[model samples]
Target chain A: MSLDKEKIKHVAKLARISVDEAKVASLTKDLNSIFKFIEQLNELNTDKVEPLTSILNQSLRSRKDEISDGKIREKILQNSPKKNEEFFVVPKVVE
Target chain B: MSNITNLSLSEILKSIKSKKISSLELTQAYIKNIENAKKLNAFVTTTFDQALENAKKFDNKPNNEQLLSGVPLAVKDLFCTENVKTTAGSNILNNFIPSYESTVTKNLWNNGAFLLGKLNCDEFAMGSSNETSFFGNVINPVGDHLVPGGSSGGSSSALAADLTPATIGTDTGGSIRQPASFTGTVGFKPTYGLCSRWGIVAFASSLDQAGPMTKTVNDCSIMLEAMSGFDDKDSTSINKKKETYSKNLKDNIKGLKIGIPKEYRVDNMPKEIDELWEKGKKILKDLGAQLIDISLPHTKYALPTYYIVAPAEASSNLARYDGVRYGYRSQKGKDLIEMYENTRSEGFGDEVKRRILIGTYVLSSGYYDAYYLKAQKVRQLIKKDFDDSFTKVDAILTPSTPSSAFKIGEKTNDPVSMYLNDIFTVPVNLAGLPALSLPAGLDKKGYPLGLQLIGKALDEQKILNIGYAFEKNCGYKNEIKKWWS
Candidate 1:
């Protein structure tokens, strides 16, 4: 089943993307086409097939468990659209 | 100085060696081009002054044999560079300057590469057409009205327009190849994980790959060599030792096996590209390479599989842009939720928002097993298609795109048509294999067709060798369409 206009609005709510009322209709159509495409996946017999992560048919590499990332907080915060001294700034949340 | 604008790196090196032009003068010429072509939207931002200033820092400017020593290459806006705006062509990242450099960009700078500017790209590399870019679409140098293809449209357009020598672009699902085909240039997406993705903005993590768009296959190799290497910072990065791209330039293709997937000749595809593929096979066969009929039976499922897998990952990846952190925020909103909604809705282009919705719905709690996990299994089937074919052939050959470049806004209104353009190229990315799009021939419509070569994992050199040989026999020149001129 495809996402209805109501469910799409709910998903937009979840994703934090505001949908214009007019766009909702078109979004509903596009989302349905995609869902139909994805619906084809249901036809595949995957009862026994293992989900593959990398296409090379290999396992992921694991390194020594250690915390090694160094201090670069200042450089990182420089690109923040809005920042408050050491932290990223945003609209006030607390009362 | 031998048209400093479009000269290959080798040609530039020769001029620099002969002292015919100083590195600073060459940088200035490119700077001039960038200034003149800024209206093309080829570059998002140009640090020309900083680049020249860096050129002046070199001790023996002309005497250095730094592969790309003085060449100014444009980077797609996705790669993070310290203090530079890395927007991924979306308003959400409109002011999100990264704090550090991506390993690829850092490697280029370490090799004394002049960072001329960041090229434009589709918003989060999501759209197949450049139309979704927040900075306005990149104008195809060939036809201002026709698309240059996307999401790496700017890189291909930049290279074609001679505004920049070459540019680095990421390919998730034909982003690099389709644009390269459309622009009539070379676009190579090395095996996934060959180039470090550290500090690059995420789209679909598993499929996002950094590669080059340039005038020739050799330039693609030279640029790819500089861009690729292992980095621990990117967990998906391969630990394989770096291979020399230039070492086997003259490799012969006498006994090379080129597979043509049977399902790729689907009836819905444009007949013009199909005709061009026929000619491509004749040329390769005439050149002594054996063309074999191979079955990649799961090819029909590639597009749907990619849509499911890519959007599923895109939804998760784009979730980070919730306005509370580092990106666009709403001017006036009541609560944090409202701010996040307003910011993203206003910040992302329509295509992005559409994908996000699809991604969210598929990966939702109750729907995950039905959509995301099932799609993962389909993805394996798609990979198996290539895996089974590689057993019979050294590499796979097909049209990079079903047709040549379409006009801007042609398919933008219809999402499925836009997705159809990637039919020929998306499978390789889903399988994490190396592939390249080089100039094959032109369609009857006067647009270019690209012959694609898909190689086994980390077998980029093999694909490049095939491309090098194809160019040798076919003698396909970079025939810039008359519309742009």
Candidate 2:
């Protein structure tokens, strides 16, 4: 499970983080070592075991479709780094 | 009232009710103490002026109907405070003020507790030591150079240093208990879903849980009661009535069955920690309790499993922070994708980036079944191991940490070695059980060692009872020597 620069780059791309070329070598080493540590889980025989989603053993409770919140549009927009009135200002996505 | 900050939460409540001390006086004392303990770096944001203003309102007419009327406490910055900056200890959320308060903090306010400030924590609550914080590492109050264990490091440090009477913290894989172990404070992570998680910054939504950090076990119980309840906002919040834990602190452990997990005997464990475990067993055994040897066979996989699951969830949860509606936005980036990449690249710290990468890799198409799915299935096995053991034993006893607080830079370079610090405490979180760490005794370096008592799901009262008995008989209390001052 030795992770290479290509794998690290792919994962970083998927995570939307750009790793500098200078730091890529060390980051690759760290991720490889972490994967090496995690490889021990392969030894466990989990053939029939179900993937655990919630530990509370309670099913998700659905509420009626209604707008209970959103009166604080101004307050919510106050945290935006770039904003115009109520809309969050972002770089143009569509050309 | 000279040493008002020295009094426990219960004592403070009594004094405030009896008119011996006003909320304004108590809050001002804590504000001064926070200033004095500035070197510990426990607080990320101190709301002393707001605290005083609320204290004035409380002094005018104390609300006896509320449980913690006029009590002062610090909240871990992860919990969003309305109109106040809630940094999850990351530059990403440096100026991210919440429009609404976290349900737990709201519960505290409804109980009449005043917020002293926002405490520091690891970036996104990722690291074991507080070193990953964007603010800085919180130094252990016991020794100036040592780390207060994290990611609830600030919460524990503040309580131990008397900067706050009690504090709130979240534990996703030992965040609350480990820091309490390092700082010689009491931290209780109740059953997952016992406290509402609405409005707290998400870090592993499934594993993350809110709890109390305090000077004494009784105070932890009281704070736990005040902070816990069902919230319609958080779907995971338990649908149950809140237990009056402070009133249920029965120290009589006559004929209770305590389990000692043999798998926790790791290789090259410190002699002091080993002796502390033995001492805990003896203390329980002497108090008319039976000690049973139990095997949590999947215990060895807990840390790896937690690392996999938590990061996988964190990567998904953190995807929301793409610099559009929040904290730091990169100045350079022609298009939206570049902006997202650059903003995240610069906003997150190294540890956070590492976890995100690991999560991305694990959840990737080809590797999904091998890593994430396997870890989840193993998680079930781990939980089953606890479920089987609880049928035989009333509670489990173990050392809170492998050793006492280490030097600040000791394990910073190696992430795996740092992750091993949560070994003993992570299993409890994976099982979604309640556990408390009590200051048991001092280690060889004269720093405090903690004894942890693990209980079954929603059985916080049982473990708190065990911790109460241990706290009374352990004869260990933190006597702050004012090292930070």
Candidate 3:
């Protein structure tokens, strides 16, 4: 149940968080402790129990598919870290 | 004028309507109080000038019809305020401002409350103590070195210190109530979806609920009235006519059945907290209510279930924060993937990064059924426990926290110990029920201890009324000395 340094690095990569090699030992220790704490859930018998999908137990409300509001692309892009001409600028994705 | 800041929201409304005080005068008084109390580090962003401008506008064209009536209030930084920098107490969003307002803040403004500022919180509302805030940890005004409970720590601290007339905070687990209990204020978490989550920085979407942290239960009722409603934007919002909690608030709970959940009496609970629970039961009994012993067998599993479910959802919700959209961007990355990794690692604090990692680990392909799905089933059992108890009693009562506030840095290194702070409060969130915490008495250290009243889904008025009765009879008042100023 304990995560090793390799697993910690793999999870970090999946989470898109960078973990330095120097810190992996401590991360492994911390994540292992948290996982150990979470292991107590294994004692419960939930074999026949249904997973809870919603708190209110109601169907999701839906609205008609129509254009509700638009025409303010500038406001939408106002908080972008890098943007030009109605699109956010990221490191070039295309090969 | 010196005592103007001490008035509650309802009192402030009365004063403004009767011409006994102008909105400008009240706002100035609060501004002075906030300025004098800078050592507490309760506020991340203070919009004093804008607050004063709004106050003056209210004074010029008086509106007595509004619920808040020009009261200047601060909210947890997790709420997105239009054009205001909403950091959610993380460095990644340190410079990010929302193009639109959150539905909760918008509702408050529509009911005539204006923003005083954004208060500090645990980063992304993750940690139990405010120590996780990237800006800085908020000091509880109750004592010099004591930590304000988080992630709504700043809201409770600010309200207790009279920095704002009243305030609002979101509770994913014990964020609002635990801080309120620590600071000797009143905090209420309404049923899930009672308050819209649109524009709120999501933590655990199913469990996160915004509620009031006020100086009195009456004020809590008033603030709740102004905040709760349905929004078309949030699909989960409860589409029902809003109840008038303030007007219906009554101290008479005669013939009401209250449940005393035996399972909440955790091992090694402080003597003072146990006594406080006993005292709360007695007060309710003296008020003509009947008490029944109840059991929620699955109570002990709430924390572990919460850890799994909250992180799993948080991992998915937070995936949107990759360097593509708004927020912090890395200057060190050579490629897109590296950019996201570098930006998130550098921008998020240690606690946030830890939760993200745990979330990512639990929801990974091989472990999803063992961790995430199992936790969800356990969560259903946790909810069922409450549902069975509610069928036997009108409301449930328990200690708000295991003990009083701890010193800053005391539990910072131990994440499990920090998670234990929300034991009693987390189950209510798991079940999506309403609960309120009011100061029952102070512990031996003169720190405040609170008693919680749990209610059925969407039954906020019931808990508020019970809290109203308890506050009237308990005779406990927070005698916080303004030593910070």
Candidate 4:
């Protein structure tokens, strides 16, 4: 399994992860090996096998019988790096 | 040692009420253990001041029936504790601390359980080994430099080291159960949504569920009572009326129909695990549980299917970590896009990035039908296998992990080798079944072997009862620290 340096960067971009030019060489090797391992899984005869999604076989357990999230608003925003009275502040998303 | 660690939470609370051991004394003992057992690396962040303050509050409260009052407990780093750093084992969120507390944690704290610290885990709750954490991999205290299993590795490691009496952990896939298997403790993942996920960092949303890891089955049941409740904050939180889980600890194995799936007897299974499985079956048989051969034909697809679906969800869930609103922000670059890329690139570990890309690729428009859609359908089929098998049995039994804990750095180099560790356990998660891993016996290398019991939905009581019965007759009683040495 060969992962080109450029492909590593491309995958990183798609995945929203960062990789430096110097680290690209090693990541390529590691990523290729990972795919190779995944490749071994390809050998299994999963033709008729169904893919498992969740441990539970039931429909999603949901709650809508009521609505109340009491208190703790101040507790929730207290640790933010930047916070206004009731809002979280961030660098402007727009120009 | 005040013997509280050995005692179940029920017994610990009773001791505290009797004034035999003060909350302060118990808290100090656990803190001391954490300090001395540095190599175990269980705690990523310690909260001594918070623990003392909470202890005082417990002393003041009426406290009629809190199961874990003043009992020191570890919190997995993935769960957001108010004002605490919850990096989810990722460097990207190193500076990110939640202004909010996760519901499960707040529930535990409200029940007067003392907070020991935030336990280490795999990065973003990914990977099989604990090595993916930015804080450094947590070590299994039971072996010669063996690894604690991931995602919930830290909590399992802590309980094994007796650094904390109990810990809260998230099991997305087999994070809680497999690590518990490796560490020789009882790790339980309740029926999905029994514990609320609000303020817990999302990994694979559909699969993530927070549960307890403790030294014994009884402590697990006690902690679950406090940790579970309906939460509007988490859309998936089940609204079953809150009930004490400890009421189910009868430990009677009579008339229990146990299902043994033949598919788990795969080629990669270790010989010792086969012996251990036979031993566990014989014990249950001796206790009068009718063991029957069953089939879960979709078992072979669980690993591949889990990888596809979990990563698909992870790609979307992790998208919230851009450098904009919170967490780590890369320094100035040409534009905002560069900053986002740089920060994430610098922040995430190798395994996390791999999953993210893999998740994105599978979920992308061109490949969705082939990868993500196919995986979801297969997942339903896997659940169907369990449902079909459950009709013939009360619970399903299997080895929690194929082998006991391997040495630290043993399987980290090969991602697939690490993924295989979750093979037996992941299928249980995909089906959203309640499961528990308890110490069954020891491998030839003297490592602990864990036995898992998977039960149908909301059958947590059934599985816990079975596990408690297994733990009662297991040879590890009173020999935790000594047996490992």
Candidate 5:
């Protein structure tokens, strides 16, 4: 129920966020406190209850599969931190 | 003309229509006030030039038929305004400008309302206090050094200080209502899917909703009608005929059954908040509404469930922010994985990182069943409790917050203490129901307090009507001094 330093590091890795070595202890403590508070939910029995995913009782509304609008690649790429001719630039992955 | 900024959103529209004041004059007055009240730190970005140009255009060729003709309003930065920066109060998005407009803001502009600025908020709408904002904490206009409740603190502060005629803020979990309660203004969170989420910077997909923060209940109704509608872009948007909230607003609660949930009386609740609830009930009774004692047994689990579900969704939504497409990217990373890690670490604030980590932890393979799944079931129970209570009562009444506005840095170190501030307001979001917070009285420290009205799903009119009645009978008026200037 409590998150240790190792587990905190692991969670950060899973989240793709790098945690500083010095701040790991404090982060672990904060997560543990929050989990301890969240542990109160264990008191209730939910064995047969269905998870409520959406609040609306209606089923998802569907529309025709058609392109509504497009053709503005430059506008779409305008906010990119790094981009070139028509694609976003990122650090190389494939060796 | 002397105090144009003092006019309500509704009054401003009326003046513009009657030619008593041109749109340019109204916009100028608000800009002047915003310039003088920079100490409040309410605005993250002010669009003064754009606002003035639009006001001049509106004055030259007025359109009085629109719902919000020639009105200038500020909105939370969480909403993406095309070509204008929408930070969501994070350093990662500090320089990012949107190419497309959010459905809600677009709706405002389409109805003849122009943008005044983007107000500050908790980063990705995560924190209970505005301290989580990368732009810095917004000072409550009511008092010196008082914390304006978050993540819609900027909207509440701006509205309270008359910097904006009215504003809209997104509420994932008590963001709009809590700040409104803290600032003695009116804030309403419409039913889930009542407002489109398209183009909004997502925090928690299921729980996030956009609503109005205004100086009065009438303005809240007017603004809500203007800002909410179904959009094709947001799949979750409710496809129903939009109600004329302003036109149908009536204080007729002759035989309406209002629920008084005893479970909301939490341990260690301040005496003034409890007294505020009682005063609210007395006002309803005086308005000829019957009050019934109701039990929402699962009310206590709302906050814990919220912390889990919201983060889990946030982690999934925020994964899109990795350094590839948009937003901040780390120059130090040599490879793609390292780039994402470094970017997130350097870009996000402490509170945002904490939530993302908590979200990551809950949804991890081993803990998914125990944490995320269990929390969802608890969420079901919480919603069911409201479902059962509503069969007997038309709406529910509770205090908006446990206490009035606290000093800055009072509970920032302790996250749970900060989360507890939304204990009374979070349940409404969990159930996806409508709720409004109206200033009812002041605490012993003279800070304003609010009482909430919870309505059934898609029943915003009911709550707004009850709030309208309460506003008439409570006779509470906020006397905020202009000390920040």
Candidate 6:
């Protein structure tokens, strides 16, 4: 159940975080220790127990389709790291 | 009058109403205290100018209906303040200013409270110690080098140091209560969905809850009332009338059954903490409450389940933080993928990155059932244990932390040891219940130790009353020796 270096790197990639090669060994060690601690859950028999989706035990409440929140395009885009007049600027995807 | 900075919230409110003290003058005093306590690192941003301007407006015509008229309070950086930088203690959102306000903060403003500033916290409300903050570690006012228990560390420390009259903090698995415990202040985490989560940076949507951190239990009660209500924006927000908790805060605990969970008696718990728990049980007993031994066998699994669920939710929520949108972006990326990878790796701290990896690993293809699904089912068992215990007892009592505040870097290197700090407090969050930590006694080094009172869902009143009873009879004075001053 211990996480290997490859698995750790894969997880970092999946999370979109770039871990340096030097830190991979330590991260793998830490992840493996954590997994070892988490392995204690295997002791219990959860054959009939249902996974808890919500602690309140209620289904998601629906709201009517309406523009309750709008008119903040400029405000929302103000914090963008790289934005032009109307769109976010990014590296060329097509090229 | 005594120093204006040292006055309680009730006293400040009363003085402002009676025209004995101007709100502007009172706010200036608080601003001065915040300035003097700069070494504590309690604030991420100080809104002194805006606070003064609002104080002047409040002074022009004090609204009778406003419960917190002209009160200056600090908010944890987790809650967004419009036109103000809301960095949830992470460098990732260091520059992310919200155009809209968090519902809880909006409620506070509507009730006539002015923001002193946004306080520091654990990045994304993740850590138990404030050292994980990108702003650097918040020093505990109790001692020169101790950590103010976190996620809500800045909130608790600010209140303890009199830097702000009161502060608002969010609790996801003991973030609010633990900091309050470490800093000798009052912290309450209301029932999930009691306060709308809209605009607060989502860490773990299912577990994160907004509540009040204050100097006294009475302040905690009223502040929670002011900060909580139904919001159409937050899907999980319960549509219920806000209960006036301060009005119903009765100290009568006669005939009430208080449960002391036997499972909480873990191995190698400090003697002082064990003695404090016994003292707390004795206080309830003397107040005519029957003490019963109950069992929450699944308590041991709470931390592991929490680590699973929280990070799983965090990984999903934080997916929006790509370099293109907001926050920090790396300059050395070759393309979009490298930009995202580099931005996240550079923006997030080691603890945040670690959690995200664990979350991604668990929710990945083959490990989902073994890790994520099993954790969720275990979470159910933890909640059920509370339900079973509550059927026999009206409320539960336990030590707020395994130990009092520790040195800044004492447990930082070891993640597992740091996670153990929330052992006594996480089970409440798993059950979506209300809980509070109150100053009960001082440890050997004269640092404050807190006793936690936990109650069923929406039973904030019960825990508040029990806390009120204890505060009156426990005779624990949380007054520090003004080290920061």
- Estimate the TM-score for candidate 1: 0.96
Q: Where does candidate 4 stray beyond 4 Å?
A: A1-8, A25-95, B60-64, B478-485
Task: Score candidate 4 by DockQ.
Answer: 0.38
Clashes by residue pair, model 6: none
lDDT of 2 at B416: 96
* Model 2 chain A, TM-score vs. native: 0.92
User: Candidates ranked by DockQ, best first?
Assistant: 2, 5, 3, 6, 1, 4
> Which ten contiguous residues of candidate 3 chain B have the minimum total lDDT?
B1-10
* Chain A vs native chain A, TM-score per candidate: 0.81, 0.92, 0.91, 0.77, 0.94, 0.92
**TM-score (C-alpha) between model 3 and the true structure:** 0.99
CA lDDT of every candidate: 0.83, 0.91, 0.92, 0.80, 0.92, 0.90
DockQ of model 3 vs. true complex: 0.84
Candidate 1 residue spans exceeding 4 A from truth: A92-95, B59-63, B481-485
Candidate 6: stretches off by over 4 Å = none
Give residue B473's lDDT in candidate 2 (0 to 100).
85
Per-residue lDDT of candidate 5, residues B1-485 (tens digit): 88888877888888999999999999999999999999999999999999999999999999999989998889999999999999999999988899889999999999999999999999999887799999999999999789999999999999999999999999999999999999999999999999999999999989999999998899999889988988878988999898899999999999999999999999999988888899999999989999999999988899999889988999999988886678888898788889999999999999989999999889998899999999999999999999999999999999999999999999988888999999998889888999999999999888999989999999999899999989988988878999977
- Model 6, B1-485: lDDT tens digits are 44877777877778888888898899888888888898999999999899999989988988856779888888999998999999999999989999889999999999999888989999999899898999998989999889999989998888999888888888998999999999888889899999999999999999999998888888888898888899988999988777999889999999999999998888989999999999999999999999999999999999888888888888999998898878999897888889999999999999999999988888999989998999999999999999999999999999999999999999988898899999999989888999989999998889999989999998888899999998999998877867887
CAPRI-wise, candidate 3 is high
Q: Candidate 4 chain B — worst ten consecutive residues by lDDT sum?
A: B476-485
| Candidate 2: regions farther than 4 A off | none
How do the residues B34-96 of candidate 2 rate in per-residue lDDT, one tens digit apiece? 898999999999898899999999999878778899987899999999988999999989878
- By summed lDDT, the worst window of 10 consecutive residues in model 5 chain B runs over B320-329
List of clashing residue pairs for candidate 2:
none
Question: Model 6's lDDT to the true fold?
Answer: 0.90
